[model samples]
Target: MEIQSTKKLVFLLLFLPIIYTTAQPLIHHHLTILNDKAALLAFKDAITEDSQAVLADWQNSSNVCNFTGVVCNYQQNRVEQLRLNGGGIHGPLSPFLSNLTGLRLLDLSENNLVGPIPPELSSLWRLNELNLFGNLLHGPIPDSLSLLSGLFFIDLKGNHLTGIIPSSILYNCTSLGYIDLSENALHGEIPPEIGNRLLSLMFLQLYSNNLSGKLPPSLSNCTILKWLDVENNSLSGELPTQTVSRWKLLELLLLSNNLFTSHDHNTNLAPFFSALSNCTHLQGIELAGMGLGGQLPTTIDQLGMNLSSIYLQDNQIFGSIPPTIVNLSNLMVLNLSSNLLNGTIPDKIGRLQNLQSLILANNLLIGPIPPSIGQIDRLSQLDLSKNRLSGEVPGNLGNLTLLSDLFLQENKLSGISPSIGRCESLNKLDVSFNRLTAIPKEIFGLTLMENFLNLSHNLINGPLPLELSNMKSVHEIDLSSNSFHGSIFPQLEGCAAARMINLSHNSLEGKLPSMLELPENLESLDISFNSLSGEIPVSLGGSLSLVQLNLSYNDFNGPIPTSGRFTNFTSLSFLGNPHICGSIPGVPVCK
Candidate 1:
C-alpha cells in the first residue's frame, strides 16, 4: 500500500508540470492583449478632440481587437490595423502608437492633427501603409522614416510640411509603390536617383509645391510608372523627351502651371507629343499654363484610344486644331482656350459623343461655328467667345438639353435662334457684340437663365418684348447699343433677381418706368443715352446696395434724391443730361 501511494504522488507531480507548460501560451496571449489595450488607451488620451466619437468604443472592458478603428489578426492574436480617417479628431499623433508593433496599416487622414510626424514611427518595421493626408500637421518629413523598409504607400499631402524631402526615404523604401507629398511647402530638386533607386514606384504626386529644377532624367528608369503629377510647382527647364518616352506604361501626366519650356525653343511640339505616343495607356494630359508653344501635333491622334481629357489652355499653342482630334471618340473635356489658335472648328467634332465641355474661347478662330456641334448631345458648356466667328447661331444647339453655359459673345454671330428656348438647362447665355436686328422672343422663356443675359453691343431693334418679364431668375441684363424704342416696361420688375441693368445707347422714348422695383441685390443701374423725359423716381435712390447710377443723356427733369445711395454718386454719373436739375454736382439746383 505504501509503494502504490508513493507512485501516485510521483505521477501527480509529473502531470502538474505538463499542465503548467500547456497554459503558458494562454498567459502570454492575455498579456499581449492587455498591452494592445493599454496602447490604444494611450492613443485615445492624446487626442484633444474626438467630435465623431471614433474612439468611444475603446474601453478597458471591451476587447482590444473589437475597439473602433481597430482591426486584428485573430490567428496571431494581435492588432493589425487602425483606420480613423476623417474622424474630426484634433491633436498630435501619439508616440505611444509605436507600442502597437504588429500594426500593418495606420490611417488617420483628413483630421486636424497638428505638429510633426513622429519619427519614432520607424520602429514599426512591419507598417505597410501610413496615410495622414489632409491634416494640419506641420514640420519637415523625418529622414528616420527610411528605416521602415516594408512601407508600400505613404500619403502626406495637404499639410503645412516644409523643407526638402529626404532622399533616404525614397532610396530605402524600395517597396513603396505610391507616395504623395503634394500641396505642401516642400522645395528643392528631386533626388536624381529617384527612378533608379525606387523601381517599384507606380504613382508619384508632388504637385502644388515650391519644388524647382528640371525633372530628374533618371526618372526614365521607373518603367512601371502609371500616374505622374508635378503641376503647380516652380519646376523649370525643358522636359527630357527621352525620359518622357520611357514611361511606356504611363496613364496620366499632369505638368501644368510650371515654367517648363520647349526643347526646341517653342518651334515644334511634335517631338514632345511623339514621345507621349509611346505611352499607349495614356488617358489624360494636362499641359496648360506651362508656356508650351508650337502647333498642336496632328499626330495627337496617336495619343491612344483611352484619351479622355486634354487641357492645353493658357498656353502659346498656335495653329488650327487638327481634325484628327475628332478621332479621340472618348474625349470628355477638350479645352484649348487662351491660345493663339485660329481656323474653323473641326466639322467632325460631333463624333466625340462623350464630350461634356468644349472650351475654345479667347482664340483667333474664324468662320461660322460648325452645325455639327449640335450633334454632341452630352455637351454641357460651350465657350467660343472672343473669336472672329460669324454667321447665324446654329439653331440645332437647342437640341443640347444638357447645355448650361453658352458663351458666344465677342463674335460676329448674327440673328438669334428661337430654338435656343428648348435648352431648359441653360443657365448663362451671352450673345453680345453681334448684329441681331431683333431679340429672340424665345430667350425670355429661359427661366433657368440665372447667371445673366447679355445682348449688348448688338443691332437689336423694335420695342422691347414684354416676354422679358418671365426671366425671374436673371441676375444681370444688358440691352445697350440696341435700337429698341418704347417706354420701359413696368413688368420688367418681375425679374426678381436683377442685379445690374444697363439699357443705355438705345433709342427708347417716353418716361422712365416709375413702378420699377429693382431687386434688393441691385448694385448698378444705367439708363443713359435714351430719350426718356420724366421725373426720376424718388424710390430709385433708396436701394441699399446700389453703388453706381447713371441717368445721363436723357431728357428727365427732376431733383435727384439726396438720401440713401444717391449721396455716393458724383457729377460724372449725371453728365450728358442738360435738362436735369438735382442736388448732384454739375446739375442746376432744384428751385
Candidate 2:
C-alpha cells in the first residue's frame, strides 16, 4: 500500500512539469512569430529605397514583438496589431504577412508599394481593419479579398488600380463601414447589388474615375449611406428624384458630369431641386457640363441652402432670368452663356453682391444697360457682347473697380460715358460696332490697359487723340473703318507701348510722322488710303519687333528704306504710291 501511494505522487509531479513546459513558451512563440511576420511585410513594402535602412532595424531585430509598429497583447506577448502608415515603402507586398493569424489590425497606407495585392493577405482571419491607400498598385482587385470576414474599414484611394470591382467582396463584407477607391482609373459600373448587400456601409467614395452606365435605382436602399460621390463619369440617366426623399440622412450626393435631364419639357425642376431641401446640410452641388435643358425652377428661391458654389454652365436652359435668384446670397459664379434665352437682363442681377463672373453673351437679350449692374462690388468679369442691347453705357461701371475684362461690342450704343475711365484695373476693353463719335480722353488715359483696344466699325471721327499716349501699356489698337481724320500724329512715337496700330480707310493727310521712332516695339503698321507723303523711315528698321508694315495708296515720294530690319519686306507694302522708288520688287528702281 505504501509503495503504490508513492508511485501515484510521482506521476502527478511529472504531469505538472509537462503542462508548464509546453503552455508557457508556446504562447510566447506564437506572439513572436506573428510580430515578426508583420514587420517583414512592412519592410518589404517601404516606399523609398532609403526606407530600407529604417526597415532594416525591424528586419534584423531578434525580438520582433518589441519592433517598431508592432504591438503584442500583455501576459502572452501575442501580436495584436501592426500599423505602418505613411512609411514610404516601395515594393510588392510580402506573402509572409499571411502568417500573422492573430492580427486584429493591419495598416500599411500612404506607402509607395506597387504591383498587385497579394491573395495571401486574405489569411488574416482575425483582421478587423486594413488600410492601403495612396499607393501605385495596379491590376485587378484580388477576388480572395472577400475572405477578410472581419474587416470594417478598407481604403485603397489614389492608386493606379483598374478593373471591375469584385461583387463577392461587396456582398461578403458585412461588417464594412467605410470603403474608398477614389482618384484611380477604375472602370465598370457600380454593381447594382451594392444597395442590398452592403447594409452596414456608411461611406463609399468612387469619384474621379471613368465609370459608365446608368446609376442603379436600388442605390436608394442604402438607408445609412451618408456620402455617395461618383463624379466625372459617363453615367447617363435622369437623377433619381425620389432618392433624396428616401435617404433623408444623406449629407452629400455628387452626380456631376453624368447624364441628368428633366423628364418632360414642361417638367418644373422645382420638384427635383425641392427634394434636396430635406438635406439642408448638403454643402456642394456640381451639375456643370451635364448637357441639361430647361429653365431654372423659380421654386429654387424658396429653399434656404448654404451652398458655396453652383456650376450649371454648358446647358440648353432658356427663359427670362428669374428675379427670385437673389436668394443665393453666397453665389460666386453665374455662368448663363451659350443658352437660347431671350429677354432683358434683370435689373436685380446686380444685387448678387458676391458675384465674381457674369457670362450673359450669345443670347437674344435686349434692353438698355441696367444701372443696377454697377451695384455689384465684387464683379470681376462681365461679358455682355454679341447682343441687341441699345443704350448709353452706364458711367457707374467705374464702381466695379475690380473689373478686369469688359466686353460690350456689337451693340447700338450711341454715346460715350467718361465714367468708364474710372475702372483703373481694366485689362481688355472692346466697344466696336457702335455709334459713338468720340471716346473720352480719359478712356485712353488708363495706365493699367494691357490687351486690345478695338473701336472698329464705329462712327468715331476726328484725329487720333494725343491723349492715347496715356495708354502706354496697350498692345494693339484697331480704329479701322471709321471716319478718324487728320494726319497720323508723330507724337504717337511717345506711346511706345503699342505693338500694332491700324487706321485704314481714313482721310488723314501728312508726311509719315518722324515720331514713329518712339514705338520701338511696334510689330505691325497699317495706314492704307491716306494722303501721307515722304520716304519710309530708315529708323523703322531699328524696330526689332516689326513684322508687317502697310502704307498703300499714299502720296509718298522717295526710295523705301533698304537697310536694317526693313530689308525683309517686299515692294507690295509701297503699292499705289506711284512716286516711291526702292530695290523692292514691283517698285521703280531708285539709283
Candidate 3:
C-alpha cells in the first residue's frame, strides 16, 4: 500500500503540470470574452431609450457573440464591430466604448444620443469607419480624433458641435477617403493641409457651418476630389480661380450663401465660366446668395456637358438669358431668381427636357414667356413671378402633367387658359397682379391645389364660381382687388382646409354669405373695401381661431357682437362702414 501511494503521488505531480498547461490558453480566452460581455452591458446601460429593444438580447446568460449590435471575431473572441444606428437610443455616449479595443467599425448614427462625443474614441487604433451623424452631440470636435490614423471614413454631420475644426486631422489621418462634418456649428478656416495630406480623399462636405475665410489654394492639389460643398458658411473673398479650373474630376461644387466675390477683374463671369469649363465631369454648381455681380458669360454654353443643376440666384448677375444656356440639355434645375437678368426667356428654352424646376422670379425679364417652355416634360416647379413678362400665358403650359407649383404672379399675363385645367398635379397656383377680366372655369377644377389660389390684384370680374367647392384641400383663397361683382357663393364653405379668405377691394355686392362656415383652422378673414351689405354674421364673432378680421369699407349694418375673437379686435376692423356700431372701442353702441 505504501509503494502504490508513492507511485500515485509521482504520477499526479507530473500529470497535473501537463493538464494546467493545456487549459491555460482556454482559461485566458474565457476571461477575455467575459470582459467584452461586461463592456457591452455597460454600453447598454448608458442608453436611456432603446424603445425598439435593440439591446434586449444583451444578457449575461447568453453568449456575448450573439448580443445585439455586436459582432465578434471567432478566432480572437473579441468584439470587432458594433452598429446600433437609428435605434431610438438617447443618452450620452458611454466612454466605456473604449473597452471594445478590437472594434474595426462603429456606427451609432441617426440616434438621439446627446452630450459631447467621447474623446476616448481616439484610442480605437484599428477603427476603419466611424459614423455618428444625426446625433444631438455638442462641443468642439476633439483634436484627439486625429489619432485614428487607420480610419478611412468619418461622418459627424447634423450635430451641434462648435469650435474650430482641428487642423491636426488634415495633417494626420492620411488614409481618410471620405469626411463629412457638415451641418454643424463648426467655425474657423478650413486647414489648407487638407489637400496636402489627405491626397486620397474623394469627398469633403463641410457645408452649413459658420466656417469663414477664403478657400485654401492648396485645395487645387486634391486632383482626385469628386465632391466639395462649403455652402451656407460665412466664407468670404474670391473663389480660388486656379483651383476650380483644375478640378477636372469634380462632380459637385456647392458654395452658396457665402460672401465670395468674383475674382475676374472685368466683373464678367466669363473667366469663372471659362475656368469651370476645364472640369468636364462637373455635374452641379450652386453659387447662390454670394453677392457675385457680373454678366453671366455667354461662354456658359462651354460648361461641362454633364452639368445638371445651376443655382445662381440672389446675386447681382445681369444680362439677358443667354441663348447658349440651351446647350446644357441635361440641366434639371436652373434657378436665376432675384438677380438683374432681363430680356425674353430664350425661345429655345424648351430644349431642356430634363428641367424639373426653372425659377426666374424677381428679375427684370420681359417679353412673352416662351411657349417653348412647354417642351420640358418633366417640369415640376415653374416660378416666373415678380418679372415684367407680358403677353398671354402660354396655354401649352397645361401640357406639364407633373407641374406642381406655378408662380406667374406680378406679370402682365392676360386671358386665362382653359388648358390649365389639364394640370392635375397643381399644388399651388398664383397669378395675382395681372390683367384678366374673367376667372377661368378651368382654374377652379384644380382639386389638388392644397397650398393656395391667389388671383388678387387682377382685373378679373364675374360671379364667384360654384366650382370653388371642388377645392376641398385649398388652404387659402385670395380673389381680392378684382372686379368680381356678385354675392358671396355659399359653396365657398366647402373649402374645409381654408385658413384665410381675402375677397376685399372687389365689387362683391348683396348680403354676406349667410353661413361663412370657415374651417376650424381659419385665422384671417379680409373682406374690406367691398360692397358686401348685411347684418354682421353672429357666427364670425364666436370663432376661436379667427385672429384677424377686416370687415371695413363694407355695407354691414348691425351691432358687432363683442364675444370670442371679436372682443380682441379694435373698431378699425369695422371702419369705413358707418352702419356698423358695436361695443368695440371708438365705435358708438348699437341702438
Candidate 4:
C-alpha cells in the first residue's frame, strides 16, 4: 500500500504544472477584461442616485459590454463607448474610468453629474469624442486633455465649467474639428492660438461665457470654419474685416452682445460688408446689441445672395434704409430696431419677397408704412412701434396671412384697416399708445390669439366687441384707458387660458361677471377706474389663483368676502367703491 500511494503522489505532482501552463492564457484574458469591468463597477458605485435604474443589470456575472449605455468593439473584449445622456444619474464621475484605456467615445450629457470632470480622463489617449454637456459639472477643464491626440469632437457646453479654455488643447489636439464650450461660466480671452494649430476646426462656439478680449485675427487661419458664435461675451474691438474676409466658406457668424465697432473708427460699416461679400455660403449674421455705430451702407449688398438673416438690433446705427438693401433677394430676416436711424422705410422694402420678419421699432423713421409691405407673403413678425410715423395702417397688411406678431404700439397709427383680421395666424397684436379711434371687431375674433391682445391707451370708443371672447387661448388682454362702454359680457368666459385681464380706466359700465366665469388661470383682474356697477361677486374671494384684484373706484356695493384669497389682498384693492367694505387691512368692515 505504501508503494502505490507514493506512485500516485508522484503522478499528480507531475500533471499539475501542465494543467496550470495550459490555463495561463484564459487567466490573462480574464485579467484584461477586468480592466474595463472594474472601472464600470466603480462608476456604478459613485452614482449616488440613479433614478433611471441605469445600472440595474450591471452585475459581475454579466459581461461589461452588455451593461446599459455601454458599447464594445467587434472582439467584445474591450469597452469602446459609453453613452449615458439624459439618464438622470447624480454623483461625481468616477476617476476609475481612466482604467478604460481603450475607450474611444464617452457621452454623459444631459445628466445631473456634478463635480470636476476627472482630470485623469486625459489617460484616454485614443478618445475621439467626449460629450459632458448639460450637466452640473464645474471646475476648469483639465488642460491635460491635450493628451487625446486623436480626438476630434469635444463638447463641455451647458455646464458650470470655469477658467480659460486650455490653450494646450488647441495646440496639441490638432485633429479636433468641433469644440463647443458655450453656455459655461468660462472667463478669459479666447486664445489667439485657436486658429494657429486647429486648421481643421469648422464649428467654434464659445458664446454665452464671460470671455473678454478682442477677437483674434488669427481665427482667419481656420478658413474652412462654418459657424463662429461668440455672442454675449465682452469681446471689444472693431468688427473684423480682414479676418472675416478669409472665411469664404462661413455660414453663420454671431457676434451679438459684444463691444464691436465698425471700421473707420466705428462709424463706417462698408468695409465690414465688403469683407463678407465673398462669403457666398453665408446664411445668417447677427451683430445685435453690440452698440455698433454705423449707417446702412450700400455695400450691404456685398453680404452675398445666400445670406438669409441679418440682425443688427439695439445699436446706434443711423441712416435711411438704403435702396441697395433690396438687392438681397433671399433675405429672410432684417432686424434693425432700437437704432438711431431716421428716414422713411424704403418704398421697395417689399422687393425682398422672401423677407419673413422686419423689425424697425424704436427708431426715428417717419412716413406711412408702404402698402407694398403686404407683398411679403411670408411676413410673420413686423415691429414698427415707437416711431414717429403717422398714417392709416395699410389695409393690405391683411395679405400677410402668415403674420403672427404685430407691434405698432406707441406710434402715430391713427386707423387700423379691418382687413388686418385676415391675418389668420396672428398670435399677438399690440396697438396700444397709438392714435386709434376704434378696434375692428374682426381683430377680436382671432381665436389664434394666444399670447397677447393689447389695445390700451387708445381713443377707441365703442361697445366692447362680443368677439373678444373668441380669444380662447390669449394669455393677456389689456383694453384699459379706452372708451369701451357696455355691460361686462359673460362671453369673457371663453378666455379659457387668460391669465391677466385689465379693463381699468375705461368707460365700461355694467355688472361684474361671477368669479367662476373668469379664466381658470386668471391671476390678475383690474376693473379700477371703470363705471362697473353691481354687487361684487362673492365667488371672487374663493379664487385659488387670483393673486391680484383691483376693483378700486368702481360702483360696487355690498360686503366684500373676507375668506379665501380675499384675505390676501389689502383695502386698496377695493378702495373708492363707496358701498363696498371688506375685512382687509386698512379697510372699514361693513357696518
State each model's CA lDDT, in order. Answer: 0.89, 0.77, 0.88, 0.89
Per-residue lDDT of model 2, residues 1-591, tens digit only = 999999999998989888888898887776577565665655465435676754665654456766668887655566778888887777776667777777788888888778888888898888888888888888878889899988888888888889987878888877888888888888888888877877777788888888888777776777777788887787877766776656666666777777777656534456677787776655556566676677777766543455545556666667777777777777766676666667788887777788888777766788888888899998888888877888789989988999988888887788768988999989898888877888888788787788888888888888888887767888888888788787776666666788998888777887766546748788998888777788777776777888888889889988888878778887777789999888887889986
TM-score of each: 0.92, 0.72, 0.93, 0.90
Q: Give lDDT for model 4.
A: 0.89
Clashing residue pairs found in predicted model 1: none
480 Cα displacement, candidate 1 (Å):
2.8
Alpha-carbon deviation at 235 in model 1, angstroms: 1.6
Over all chains combined, what TM-score does candidate 3 have? 0.93
Model 1: lDDT of residue 274: 95
lDDT of 4 at 348: 89
Q: What is candidate 1's local distance difference test score? A: 0.89
Report the Cα RMSD per candidate: 2.7, 6.3, 2.5, 4.1
Output candidate 3 Cα RMSD. 2.5
Better of 2 and 4 by TM-score: 4
Higher-scoring candidate on lDDT, 2 or 3: 3
Candidate 1 TM-score versus the reference: 0.92
Residue 102 miss distance in model 3 (angstroms): 0.9
